[model samples]
Target chain A: MKIAVDAMGGDFAPLEIVLGSIEAIRENPHMEVVLVGDEQQIFTILKENNEQKNPRITVHHASEVIGMDEHPAQALRKKKDASVVVATALVKDKQCDAVIAPGSTGAAVAAALFGLGRIKGIDRPTIATPIPTVNGVTVMLDSGANANSKPKHLVQGALMGSEYAKLLLGKANPTVGLLSIGEEASKGNEVVLATYPFLKKLKTISFYGNVEGRDIPKGTVDVVVCDGFVGNVVLKFAEGLVTAVTQLVKDGIMAGGIFAKLGALLVKPAIKKIGKRLDHTENGGAPLLGVNGVFIICHGSSKAKEIKTAINIAGDLVDRKIIEHIQKTIEVEGAFKYEYDE
Target chain B: MKIAVDAMGGDFAPLEIVLGSIEAIRENPHMEVVLVGDEQQIFTILKENNEQKNPRITVHHASEVIGMDEHPAQALRKKKDASVVVATALVKDKQCDAVIAPGSTGAAVAAALFGLGRIKGIDRPTIATPIPTVNGVTVMLDSGANANSKPKHLVQGALMGSEYAKLLLGKANPTVGLLSIGEEASKGNEVVLATYPFLKKLKTISFYGNVEGRDIPKGTVDVVVCDGFVGNVVLKFAEGLVTAVTQLVKDGIMAGGIFAKLGALLVKPAIKKIGKRLDHTENGGAPLLGVNGVFIICHGSSKAKEIKTAINIAGDLVDRKIIEHIQKTIEVEGAFKYEYDE
Candidate 1:
């Protein structure tokens, strides 16, 4: 149940990652944490804090890091000993059950693919993230994993997204939705129209038909599927909007006066909780589903808390055998089709 | 200038419509309002309020009204003297500078097309709405006037949008951005990709390349051109988001104690102004662009303030001869193409 964490992955790499890993190690003594990064840098960070006493947490040093701007494939090829790559390798070698990185998304994906390989029949890996909705959270797949995709790619996304939703959200045959400009199957551009039929034909999940952007926050469906391009826009807009709004709300509350301070005091906890939920920086990690191994990607700017959450998510996902469940579900689908044919 | 008002449109028709009309009459002295609706209902509403003192604002009675659920084309065909249809006729017959409605968007477009006709070279009439952006307001066209469109429709939308921008926002050659998933000409769905090259070939305005969804509020480009379906989604999302956020901000503010009430009082004026500016409700109304006459369609829930603004917009559009300008711009493209072909 050990997790290999890329300590040098995120914007607040060594310090936040170290602190978060220590938190995890403190919480779970049975599981070990392999903190991958430059040894001296991590040690120095621990020394500055004067709280590096954790038997379960060990520093597994890697001298390299994947820069955010570097091309993902090139970086993976060049930086073989990069923290993300090394961490992924640890997962492949069975040294760790799962790997976590809040670093470069592309780099992490490339390393995971190169190290552990893609799941059979999975042509593309998807980054599935839970979007807040009134009905709970809608798990939207390929949030930005691969921007351009064909109709088949979208079907793959739908399948992968369904598995993730069922595993993570504990849904009974998660209601799946195809994200489109309109709800009607006849609507949307060609890609959507084509994908609609494919998704409808798949019997692994309860295909709830098409959903629009407004349907996301409303929690109209458990699993919303789309190509990376539209999914990316919707996800990014939600991120940017929630961020912009949270700031404005905070600003509105703190608008200079004795009354504002008093008012803030009364609603501070509720506001803080809402802020935490909306903070993609905190809920920054996403499972790169469709890959064979358990891989969780955090935001580039993830801090200590988020990195720890990614690790926790990776642990839970591995424990639940999400990828295996996905395989079994696909197998069941094949069986269903074969039996029908017979 | 005399404006023809749809007195029988919207959810709170004849009431809010009449009240908004009164507000508009009070605000603009030089302008006259012709309220077109059910004679009995109009008289009853006005008499109940006892606001029939003004000679400038007169009621042109009609019994027919278009319901929101009815098909736009069907309603337009069946009810020739419906408020929306008659209002459009007012503009067509030169009885009024423009027509305003807070009713069904489809019926407004249908009736406008039936009565006012299309501007030269503009094959189909499109609904153009001014979205308040970070930079300023951007006039986006085909905001769901026609669902399915050709590449030529997009080009025409661009020309009409550009003309509206220049005339409404007073931007000298406002940069026209093709709304796509990405900035690259090739990076888009079918409709967008097919439209890009055609738009690039046109020279009526400054074509600033493709713009993405998240770029809408970021204030990158001035004119965003898209098909009806996509535009509808964008418009609705923007409307929903702004409404949700501003309400959240206000709710956060009002959560304070007694002192918070005082704090609210301090910034109430400024906050009100912000709300007013961001409020699309008071932006007069969406103009059914590409129509030959100065035809305006107000929101479904328009109040007196919005009605006044719609009338003013009509006067300005008519005074500036916006339709003639659009016609000439299209003619310029046509002449160039004709010469090149020869």
Candidate 2:
């Protein structure tokens, strides 16, 4: 299998992206990587790592780079030769089985929608993010692909998220839950209320009645489906909270005098382990599902290890034929036929 | 001043509620408490605590008690003498300066609306919850009051929340932010997009444009305003994540053998401090804003300490005349006059 990496995407672009691609290829000798960015820059980093002449590693030249602050669709339209767009195009042309873009999430989503297009019968593509839960991980969809979504779009997200869980988390029959404020079927906003009945009538996924925000981290359901707006807010809020809590702990230890400093040193390893367990990087990147091809979106600040894991995950998704399964599920279930939304 | 307490509300009813009310009156010698619940139950618990003869504490007989699982509005209509309803009615009848119900949030909200009524020019009453941030606290509003909110309601919420921060948080010119998926003005769903312009045009509040979910924890703004559905989900999700993360740290230590166990014992105090700082109980109950009377809603699982703090908060709100301030702001600013929505 071959993968295309958007070398100029993230904050530590070209350098970290090149290192991760090299590391992924080194670990999995059966696969190859195509680093899409400035040729000279990619080669310079490759030379520093002494893998400049490696047969498995290749560099595809792309002059333009989409900034982290750029408007997604407009940037993609203007910068035709942008690294992220070029990398996605490689997958579109079938030069690679999958593509990894570790830059602005908006840019990646835009490139996926523009380059690979949407799957048959899927109205919106979702960014399915794997959140760390107590028991294991829970996959939440539409984490920030589309700002606004219809009830049918959420139904499509549920099916796609379920399949992703089955392939990625190794769940035989993953339970899907609609994200809402309360557990009752009648308890959410207008969109959630409209989506609930349709989810219950679905045959493809095991539908859990309704799950609240607390249910996500408790591992109450394998797949959590919501519109992009709420999902994005939850994801970012969790991230900010974890960081703030960690800082609070550190400050507490600092204020505790000599005994506290000694204790913090002793428990540093245990605390580090806890941080690793809750870290988003441990799960690699979120997948931009519903796109015709495999596209993984990583955090802009992701280092080499996270990118490597994302590449491996992309390979697994490609081998598992996730898109095929999703397409079949949508067709067989006739998800859009429910027409519960008057 | 006299405050009415719903003695039969919370999980550890009558016992914790009566004890908390006793503690509050003991601390504030100037105030009195009316424990509204079953007369026999309240007296028995008070006698057990050796406070039955206390002159400052009185029992107001209420026959019905709304269960946590009961439908809020429906139960309030049927159970006229419910503890929460009677407690709220005391405030409405001007027999008590404020009311504190540490029971079902829905029931508390229902009782507040049904008994106290909405302040003029306010379409919906919001639950303004104080969340602990790294620096101090950030007050988030509409935290599960109105599941569906109109754009005008949000504008009213911002004005009310701003007044809440000024009186409760002690901020002179509290900045209000409309919670959305992104920080940009044009970044949210239909309601948020429509609310943004109104917030910006308001002279009463120090509008801070749009803030993301992470901003709540980061203390980016004094007031984080959103529709109740999204606000409730975010609140519950944060609670779950904090618990899950704490458990993860414990599990990590346990799984690391003898050294980890020894380190855990040493760092226990530092960890305990962090937990205490993040504990929502420390902040007491949420205030049901935009209501004509002072009504505070506590957690269903609140203990004596939490209830006591909530009683104190109720006193603070009543003393500050929060309802009057909110009403004044709404009328003076003519918040509904913006007419941004088509």
Candidate 3:
């Protein structure tokens, strides 16, 4: 299977992306990679590391790269040769099996939506994220993808989240929940209350009623659904907490006395493993589901490790045939549009 | 001032409450205390400590108490002579300056609503809490007091939150923010949208459009307002995160050897201090503002340290006359209310 990487997409861009691509190719001998960006920069990084380019990992040069602050839709239209767009088009055209980018989240989303298109019955594609909880990872959908969502959009989130969970996490019947202020059927704002009965009536997944903010960390539900705003907040808060905490502990050990230093040495590996598990930086990025094809997104600040993870995830998604599985199993009906004045 | 203490409330009640009360009265020489609970249990704890009960700290015993899991309204009616009911009555009858209970939150809300009554113009009382952030403390209101609040309730929350920020935190014009998924004016659920325009027109506080979840810890706004459910979720999530991180850090330190142990000490003080500040336990109890009088609701898990802090908070609220301030300020612009089906 072939994977297209947006080499100029993230903060570390060509350097980290190239290194990760080489590493992923090294890890998975069966996989081939297409690094899309300025050819010279990509080649320079490969040469600097004394790595040889092969048929398994090739460079697909694109002249332009989208800036983080640029309007995603506008940039895609104007900069047709932009690395993210070109990479996505390669996937759409079957030049590659899946597309991967750690660039502007907005640009990546727009590129996938415009190039690869939306999945049938999926009004809006969602970024499905598996959040870490005590029990395991509970899936939350639309993590900073679409800011505003309708009741229909929310329902689509549940369906997409369910499909993603069943296919990726291997949950036979994932329990889908609508993120709300409370569990009561009559509770929450109009949107959550309206979405409850539909979710209750659905036969797709094990529709658990509504889940609150605190429930997310407890890993209460298998799949938690909300608009991108709440999802982003929940995701970032969890990420920040994990990051802040790991740093705190590291700082403690570095500064403590002889005994505390000894204590720190006793369990560094186990703690690092736990830290790795929680870091979104290494989670192979968030996948923008509901698109016509598989598309994985890493954070903009991601380095080599995260890029490699995303590449691995893309290959895994292709191997799992997640897109086909979602299309066949989950059926989203009567999708309504939320026409914001924006 | 006479403060009614729910001696039977909290996880470590009577024992912890007794200990905390002794500390409170000892610290505040002018204050009198009223211990309200089962006479036997109260007396046993007081006698064991022999330090809490002075001429200024008296016990107003009750025969029954409300247990967790029982419906608040039902419990209030059945246990009219319950500790919480009796404690609230002290405030209602002006026998005590305020009623402080580190008990079942639902029970406390029920008692306050039934006994002291909602202040005129305030449709729903807010459990306004001052959260310690990296920047400072941010006063967030409607912290799960009423789950399904309308647009008006958010406004009420803002008013109460603002008043508290000014009166307690000493901010002249507390920057009040409507908690949404984004900082944009057009972000969030329908309720947030409806409340946004109204907040812009608000005259009381310096309204800073909207803020996302991550900003709460950054102390972007002095006062943050949202419906009960969102507020509750935010409050609980923050508390859970702080606790979870602290546990992880402790676990991390315990895992290490001498080298790591030595390092752990470097940041232990700062980490501990941060944890303590983030501890909702150290922040005292949430004040049920917009009630007829000062009513403080400590966490059900309150220990001696928390109780002492809560009592100190109660004394401050009484001295500050927060109720009268809320009434005089927000009472003029009748808070919005939803006509629910239930």
Candidate 4:
């Protein structure tokens, strides 16, 4: 399998992206990587990592790079030769099976929508993010793809999320839950209330009534479906809370004097293990589902390890034929029959 | 001042509620409490706590009790003599200065709207929840009061929340941030986008542009204003994430063998301190702002400590004349001049 990596996308840019791609190719003998960015920068990093002449490693030249803060659609339109768009184009042209971009989420979504286009029946593409829960991970869809969504869009997200959960999380029958403030069918805002009945009537996915915000961390359901607005807020809030909690622990130790310092040293390994489990990098990137091709979006601050994992995840998706599964499920279930305003 | 307590409200109702009220009055020499619930149950708990004949303690009989699982508006309409409604009625009738309900948030909101009514010129009442942050507290308005809100309603919420910060958080000039997925003014859903221009044009609040979900935990602004749907989901998600993190730390310690166990024992005190700092109970209860009377709503699982703090908070709100301040701010700012749909 071959995958295209946008080397000039994230904060670490070409160097870290190149190193991670090299590492990913070394671990998977049958896999190959095409690093899309400035040729000179890619080659210099490859030489420094001692993989410059490796047969499995290749470089594709792209003149422009999109900054982290650039407006996605505008940047994609102006920078026609941008690394992220070029990488996505490789997948569109069937040069690679998948593409990975570790830049602004908006840019990634725009590149996918513009380059590969959406599947036939899907109205909008979604970003399925894996959140670490108590027992395991729960996949939340439309994490930040579309700012505003209709009930039909959420129904499409649920179908796509259910398929992703089955392939990625290894769930036999994924139970989908609508994210809401209350657990009752009669609860939530107008959008949620309208979406609930559609999910209940659907036959392709297991609709698990309604789940509250707390239920996400409790691992109450396999897939959580919501519009991008609420899903994005919840995702970012979880990240912030984890950081604040860790800082609180560090401050507590400082205030405890000498005894707490010694205790922290003794339990350093245990704390490190916990951090690893909760680390976002360990899960790689969230897949931009419903797109025509495989597209994974990593965090902007992603380093070499995260990029490598994301490449491996892209390979797994290709092997499982995730896009094919989503297309078939949507068609068979007739998800497009629901009335939606353009 | 006298405050009415919903003695039949929470999980540990009557017993814990009565004890909390007794403790609150003991701390505030000038304060009195009226326990509104079934007379027999309240008296039995009061006698057990040795406060049956106390001069400052009083009991008002309300034959019906609203269960936690009951629907809010329906239950309020059917069970006219419910404990929560009676407590709120005490404040409406001017028999008590304020009311504290440590039960279903829906019941508290419903009773407040029905009994005390909304403030003049205010379209809806907002729940201003005080979230503990790294620096101090960040007050988020419309946390769960109205699931759906318009731009004008949010503008009213901002004015009410700013006044709340000035009085409760002790901010001389509080800055308010409109919560959105991005920091840019053009980045949120339809409602948030429409609300931005109104907030910027208004002279009452110090508009701090847009803030993301992470800003809430980081204490980036004094007041974070959003419609209740997003605010409620973010609030509950924070609670869930904190619990999940704590459990992760515990599981880590247990997995690291005997040394980790010993380390945990040595650092128990420091850990307890951190836990106390992050505890929601420490902040007491969130006030239902924009109402005609002072109404504080506590968590459903609140214990005696939380109830006590909430009662104390209710007294503080009455002393500060929070309702009058909110009313004045709305009238002075001409917040009702904006066009809105009912």
Best by DockQ: 4
Reproduced native contacts, each prediction = 0.10, 0.72, 0.26, 0.70
Candidate 4's TM-score: 0.99
**Alpha-carbon runs more than 4 Å astray in model 3:** A37-53, A58-65, A71-82, A146-156, A170-215, A218-222, A243-271, A331-342, B51-53, B61-64, B73-82, B148-152, B184-204, B207-209, B242-274, B328-342
**Per-residue lDDT of candidate 3, residues A215-315 (tens digit):** 77777889999878667766765654555545555565566566556655555664676676567765778899989888998888878888888888888
**Model 2 misplaced stretches (Cα beyond 4 Å):** A340-342, B340-342
TM per prediction: 0.80, 0.98, 0.85, 0.99
lDDT of 1 by residue, B1-342 (tens): 888989988888888888877777777778788999987788787777776767887889776999977877878788877888887777788888888878888788888887878877777888888876554677777777876666778888888888888988888888899877556675666667777777778878889999877666665778888777667756665565555444444555567455545555655543454466557876788788888888788777777777768877877897888888888999988722421211
Worst 10 residues of 4 chain B by lDDT: B333-342
Q: What is the lDDT of residue A40 in candidate 4?
A: 97
Rank all candidate structures by their lDDT, best first, as comma-separated numbers.
4, 2, 3, 1
| Model 2 alpha-carbon miss at residue A136, Å | 0.8
Model 3's alpha-carbon lDDT is 0.79
Candidate that beats the other on TM-score, 2 or 3, i.e. the better one: 2
Q: How would the docking of model 4 be graded? A: medium
- Residue B330 in candidate 1, Cα distance off native in Å: 4.0
- For candidate 2, the iRMS in Å is 1.3
Question: For residues A42-104, what per-residue lDDT tens digits would candidate 2 score against the true structure?
Answer: 999999999999899889999999998888888988999999999999999999999999989
